[model samples]
Target chain A: MTDESRPGVGPVSLATVAAQAGVSIATVSRIVNGETRRASAETVERVRQAIKAVGYHPNQLGRALRNRESRLVAMLAANLDNPVMATIAASTEAALRQAGYVMILCDTHDRPDLQDDYLNAMRSQVVQGYVMVASQPSPGLRDFVERGAPMVFVSRRSPFGECSFVGPDNIAAGSAAADYLLDRSIEEPAVVYPSRESSTTRERVKGFCDRVIARGIPADRIRRADGPGISHLEIGYAAAQHFSAPHAWPRGAMCISDQVAYGVHRLARESGVQIPHDCEIVGIDGSPLNAWLAPWLTSVEIPHPEFGPSIVELLVSLWGGEPPREHLMPHRLAAALER
Target chain B: MTDESRPGVGPVSLATVAAQAGVSIATVSRIVNGETRRASAETVERVRQAIKAVGYHPNQLGRALRNRESRLVAMLAANLDNPVMATIAASTEAALRQAGYVMILCDTHDRPDLQDDYLNAMRSQVVQGYVMVASQPSPGLRDFVERGAPMVFVSRRSPFGECSFVGPDNIAAGSAAADYLLDRSIEEPAVVYPSRESSTTRERVKGFCDRVIARGIPADRIRRADGPGISHLEIGYAAAQHFSAPHAWPRGAMCISDQVAYGVHRLARESGVQIPHDCEIVGIDGSPLNAWLAPWLTSVEIPHPEFGPSIVELLVSLWGGEPPREHLMPHRLAAALER
Candidate 1:
């Protein structure tokens, strides 16, 4: 039989797609959203049959209007000057654009009140999803989630069980840095990273600490320093000042972010401490600019590009009525600076 | 004493404020928008009195809703990785926030189609104002302007004459850079900047070139090269490669952006061009992190903090119904990286 002669042949709309597919409108919406559910063989077959019978291409904006959805995604960033966050925002936006969505970029500047305000403001915008990078969610965030807008956390972990997350494997990143430093036979390693409070910083430190302990390094042999989470370079300089003094320095060091690594480089140069020879160093977040930094950053490559795809998958699934889950993407330890 | 007994006592709506203040509501709105208008001393006093008497806090949001006006401002940026734009966005947002407004940031990634799409989307949102930083204005941009959203160009100058603009004094920055380089007595000079098509880059180059010509050096004597606008380090590397040949190289150079300066530094180092001795360089946009780059960056400081106040002044003025005009902010060149 010719394609046009098939039964249930018609133009695809919410109604026709639902009826011919033998499913409810909500089910069709869920299927389109890519929700996690196993449809019955017969129902799935019917839907597939209907979809094929009528070339139904759902109008994103039309559906959004009907649901009062903005089709606009909000990305809350704590700081953009931090290359890591910039990279994350750029990649995430790129992904969002491909998925037929416009992202509203909001910089919270690590202020609780501002963060709350943006969250509150977002509530009236009819936004479909939210993406936050290393931001501390406030009461407004909970209210937003309750309003049925799916949210994804990037570079930050949320205590809220319902929100999905996409970020680098911080634990592995830390462990790899330790291994890199130790592989070069640096016994006493010092770790300097941003904010002692940030989960990202803590996770990296944890991995490095675990690995250093696993390698038989004494607890006292490892030194730790914390600085402003976003201003890694500033912290690196501070760490360097302490390290430059004869009694204050550690034998080896790993920076929490590439920006901090840049600071360490400057300090080492100013103090005449040769990298890898004086104090081997590594940074995380593997910004592309690291390649051009003076000594080229020996950093953990946190698949910044993959963030775009991963975020889309999560958002699409959520829109499809799927439950939220945390996703951890693997990182590559680029020892570019070592050579 | 009763409100009537007081000098400021009256019916304090538009009429009272107008009657007591001896100014029209339009004038009050203009003052609120930060427009520079000459209101009589008595009028100013009366307006203040009327405002205080009636507690006339402008309901920006409420007014917007009733009139189908979106007090939301849309900012179209090419890239957030460029810290300058981020700083500007942050500053602008802060200014708008104080006025009970929020900014919608869209990254066009230098694509005309994306810019068009974003413009259309912003139009649909009924944004009160628009700010764009784009090197080239597409057809969609023209259409957007015609559709009647008051827009101000930042950094990027549009070919159209109708739009208002807010940008740094590029000529001053360039001359300042040249002055710094010459004060150091580096005779042979090279220039590395983004593509000449960029308004800022062109302005900087013209200023620098003019200074060089005035110093009795022929225009052709300057070693100049333009690279892909995206990567700063690449431009730096290219500069280094050009100057670090086995033969003679320029003794000094100025980069368009700090990111580009980093690249130049890397290339110079790789080519064994010693900074401040064999070569010295200056960069634009004095980012805080510039000091962290190895050897730091000698850059022209653009006042990022003031961006918020300036943008708000312009936006509020437009909101109050003023015609478009240009505003220029000054810059200072600082010796960030000195040997």
Candidate 2:
């Protein structure tokens, strides 16, 4: 097949176009790069002809180097193993691609030093914009902005005033969980999650608390548990054990995540507690896996697929020199298993 | 504090170290780079003094440039949203880090072009090795290996030779699922998953089939379905509807993944099918989330945390000039809800 029509491998580069046209590299570059003001019509036409003949594709990185606008967006994430973050990454990539931007991914693993390294690397690479999902931002991030680079936060809002943030409306998600439990006629519900220190967990808890207060549920009716980490099963087992202990258990529960809820469900089943009938449960971050349980879990759908658009919008705004802002997408309250 | 000790800042680069030492950049670089075969002990001592004074932490990229070994492993996954693949990524990163290697991640979104782009980028960046959990090597990957880059495949074996692979013994996992169902005294059990194109899926099916054949269960007794893609809920809903149909469904089933098993559980509950007593379900990929679901899924636990170390070992072996081979780690069959 001709190189022009090759499936995976593309055409030759701009240098080949210059060679084919018997012209200076500068002339060919100027013509192809649309610096028509500097190029003669005949020269431009010759360069175009050469480009067509050699099937030349301009180097995106080289072009970006000259313009200082790479049309490349960098996304820094703490963990891709989290389905929520992965969905956000996928969505953001699609949205950015649609806007004629390429994406480069970096994983910080929640380490401050690594985040600093990535910020500098993104700067040196001259990516047009950045999206950071990790909660902690290193000093280098501030330095990068001071040195002139635009960035947006997703899933984590930066304390600094210069960066925009996009994520789910955690408070609404939490409140919705409370509403679902209350509507199910359950009186008191415990809350379980990995850490209350995180913005997501805090917001979720705040909403749940506000709703519980609004309903005039006694303060002593609520319980809270800090899960070990993302290992949801352990959290569930522990929480279940705590809840099933004689009269200490709350009548209902809201897990900070679906994974944790699964753990609770397992522990409850093992403990011989009936679900929904004895104690109702709700989870956040509606995962696809939750549906496979014998009793369908009631959950708050975080709109993971749409997270990309929200992140891309923030990045575009930053690229255009807009002030930092925050955006929270709506939540979805899923139905629970029918008795 | 010295900039090196700056909290939330990154490690000081070689440039800073050279500047702090007040020596020629080359001299400091030579010393730090262990080019000491020719350098005098005094010169090395001076460089070391400067490094200590500045608290110089070497840039990993620069170190790689000098040594021709990045010690930065790259993992290219098909879909980060898939919980199974996410576990693999997490496990692999943890393993590589323990071995003093940082990990770079890429999600190819199951596209050949995207896969090729990531492979090419990883190769150009001079990543120390590759751990791929995706199917089908892109042209860039094949070309890269032809030019000599160490690689290890996880989950999927490549058509090309000269690469190491590490994954579950699918035959064993599948057979175990079948044997477990039979152990429960179920006459017939159905197998469920989303796609047939996956190599892992094929292996799982083969293993399950082999066991069933040995048990004298007719081939037609194994019913298969597209469990769910990114939506296990849909799979659960579908399984529920299928099994709840007027005609009787199988008394037991084996799901391809934990996510799928989750759906089967839901289906059974919605259909008023009692697990183990009326129907039983089992799945692969021991995601911690399985613990919270009612009836607690019976699953095969692939060693997720050790996955990374195993892959790194394979890469190191290849780097040491080992020939193409396949390695399987032992796994556990855990009964979270039922024995």
Candidate 3:
């Protein structure tokens, strides 16, 4: 792209101005972004003229160069398509903005390499800190933490426990989903779960299984189906196709997420199965987008009203060299919210 | 945030390394990131030891500083919550990455000032180029365009046509929506449109009205509803409430977006109105997320399979200083797509 097209790339450097003015790039930068005290009046005029002629731009980089700080925080999200994650990112950005810190967003799409790249790039750029919503774990992130990089994790924790985390109580959310199914007299239930590569899903499934076994339900009775290949829809379809059979489908199902629920519902309709009547479905994360659809995706919502602000606060604490803390937000089922 | 919490901000400058090593920061920087030929072996060792002692982190900034360039492209989107926008963003990011550039995302939340802030910040950070989906027009964007900052407009044209754009032909989409409604034998068709701040909405409304008038339908017969307090549901709820007043409701309504159609469907259902049988609705930008819901929110499907790649190519052309080209991607109604 033309120099103009590349706005994110560094603009014409002070060196260009210096070359035109017969001065130094350092001289030009000092005169442009910082105090022009070191340069003589004649030299300053020459540098200014050269800068104007070269179309040189001096921005935050000048200030950052002098102070050696960018005062910027970035949030590495796994995917922006997920409304729940999007909400968290928005709130975090807003909270950071209000606190006079600019937020840079990078979505990794669950690729560990991409996650590492963003982390490395941001570090190279001298971003102040980061808040990560680890859709998937990245060893690169762990390296940063090991190197004493300040970070706050959300939705997923650092596998090594070297960082602070503020996230939902998945165990509670899973238990609520289980209790709802048991109360509905669903004797045989199935769990449509994504890969256990995700800690959140693992915790949720564990909580659910513990609750079910405690209620005297045999572990063998509860069917576990691999929900989706990626935990969005197609995988849910696969899981639904596997679990749903004539007179053999589970009476109730706990989905990894509402997205999985949507897929299950679509698959069931295609198969001519009735929801609630034949099989009831409950999922986690009652996303706002679900409100657009009929028969609201009954979900257990993890209360995260303070998620954004709390994470920001946690980052601040980390900056102050505080020990890493695991903060769990509460959760509630949709029915409980109404009551 | 503390000094350590902010890894992105300038971490341990050459000055610190110099102070520890009893040398100049510039000398330290040159030896550490640049050439070390000027510095003696002992001196370089002292600088290195100091750097390690001070916890100085040398990252990507060192490379960027020397070259004054970073291959980064940014997409300024209005909202990530909308799956349509998210899809576009994901595609664009993937395309950019494929072309050996990193994509930085900034969601404007449909606010002009925030958009401006991101633009300014990106500029300060020396980003190479930008692809804008103008949520709202602000002089700041126009100023950048006039200054000839490489920009590519998506979904909207630059108010001051100094840049290239890649988007759908909204006029034809609107005409198609009108023709479909007319073919259904609806006479009293009303247009549920948001404020004409968006050129996309303006073009769609104009085409619909022009087509209706050409079809011998009285221009006055087709009513228009105020469609936004915000583009998605709340205003749609308001429009639905206004339209469904006993005998006043329009027999057919052309909504500005599928989101608006969804809101109308919800409001109608609450009022016990049968869809298609009593009221037929059509909207624009058939989002993939809409498929999850029952009774599909029929819309004009703008063929954007190449949106991400096409726009990336357009930006590449702009970077090459090619003339600004207005690229109109094709579109078809959802009904037409099925056929």
Candidate 4:
């Protein structure tokens, strides 16, 4: 079969069109690359017709190689199932598009192996930079950083501590959650977190514990509920099992994430425990859907919409050879937590 | 500044490494491309050291151009905020990664302009195939199809036809929803949909109306709530505004999506309308989170996990020159609707 008729055969090349147009390959390349000023109108028209006749699809790979640039950036995210991650990705995609860069999003699902695979693949694709959301440290990532690749962390900080980061102040969020519960006269509040492996979780837990202790609540009075950290919702649900009875539950609690709060709420409803009336709960990462879906849940709202712009700005700054910087976005109490 | 020290000056090419190693550029290329058998062990080691010393980063673009394959596929989706879309994307990415192809996910947010932009960008990137999730067709998409590119439609069919589709049978889902309400001895059920423009919505509406009409319910008796169709949640919430009073709401309703159902549920709770007791609601796209988050809202569960494998299988088939075929996955009533 002819090249054009073959299914997986490569498209007609610039050489084929150049041969058909009876012009030099360089001339064809110039016209195809939009450098029409160097070619005569007649020659350009002839080359264009030859391109159509031969069905030549200008290979972007070739063009990018020639220009020594690929306007592609990869966003390696831990999870997309989390609405917060999805929101961040959506907004980041828009911001990147506006800046004339196409984003390639890869979901690592918080697996180190998958993260490495994506990192290696991205390298092969020559992605200009990376935006890692809740990234886990891996040898591949470290290698890329060592190579001086531009990258920015979002919603988490790099363990290596040399990359730019854009996220909410987790310690403050934890402190605020503590203060909110304490102000409500709930003296013995608990903090439920998936795992301390995450920088955000560790900082939040630290802040919560420190604040509760400083407020004259004995350290032992501040209960701690921990889970395997695989799934936030499952973590909260499993943690709540320890306090199966309504009276066994603390007067107030702080969940590391909104999803964890949902889990707690689910278990509480099943166990006949009323929210706020029995156990006031606060969560972080106030999802955009809270206003419509969970208006009653009081939580520290991370500005997810602003994350896209902040991440893109940091990436640009990194690309411009600026020293690594950290941007702490402001957070606020959303819904019932505002009071 | 030397290329190694200059940021974004392009990586040190194979030529540089070859020159430093005192070998032909072709030899260096073969060795770097993993053709180690063709080079002497000593030469290979020398080349490797030269590569490191010169800070050479292999450009995949040039390699891809030579191979006439990118090992990349682009998923152009309508919206990522929708949990269903995010689920599909995550699963598809895993499947594609397993098949040795990296997915580039682009969220168009249901805008025609953005769709066109992503399409154009993907073409320039030379994506091998496309997985369109509820895609809005545009001139660029038409051009790609006209060029005989491989593509598969997910959760929606291509408007132009001739493309493989993988999704739940929406008509059956709608009929099931209607049957579910009718079995409860509830008559005068209303169908709430964001827009009939979507193939899924159109089919669901048809099935619901047909089933209702066939059951002796007059066409006029079945109230239809419509919204501008921008946001599914807002659509359902706005549609619920017509039935502001608890008594005004129909005894049963079928929401086009789970998200829309959430909107209706939100409004119903605000209006003091008890679910199932005052109004029973059924939705489509039973999100994975429903078991944990929305067990009470009945929904037709689309097999989102299966979607990834099915879409990848179809893409492979299309690549192998097989004729386009439709694969309608099985859907079942989830949660309370099962009975």
Among these predictions, the greatest lDDT belongs to 4
Q: Tens digits of per-residue lDDT for model 2 on B155-223?
A: 888746656889889889999999988887777688877653677778888898889879988888777
Please give each candidate's TM-score: 0.79, 0.76, 0.85, 0.94
**Model 2 DockQ class:** incorrect
**What are the chain A TM-scores of the candidates, in order?**
0.77, 0.84, 0.82, 0.91
Q: Compare the candidates by DockQ and give the number of the best one.
A: 4
Error of 2 at B75 (Å): 2.1
lDDT: worst 10-residue window of model 1 chain B: B3-12
lDDT at residue A115 of model 3 (Cα atoms): 91
* lDDT tens readout by residue for model 4, B1-339: 254422243656778889899999999999988999989999999999998777676766666667767788999999998889999998899899899899999998888788888876776676778999998878767766666778899988987768899998989889999998898887899989885468888999989989988998889989898777678988989888878678899999999899888888788878889876788889998876666656668998888988999999999999898999999999988855212
Q: In model 2, what is the error at residue B33, expressed in angstroms?
A: 7.3
Candidate 1 segments whose C-alpha is farther than 4 A from its true place: A1-66, A145-148, A228-230, A239-244, B1-66, B244-246, B294-296
- Deviation (Å) of A134 in candidate 2: 4.5
The worst-scoring run of ten residues by lDDT in candidate 1 chain A lies at A2-11
Error of 3 at B250 (Å): 3.6
True contacts kept of each: 0.26, 0.21, 0.54, 0.50
Note each model's CA RMSD in angstroms: 14.5, 6.3, 5.6, 2.8
Task: Give model 2's DockQ, 2 decimals.
Answer: 0.20
Cα deviation of A17, candidate 2, in Å: 13
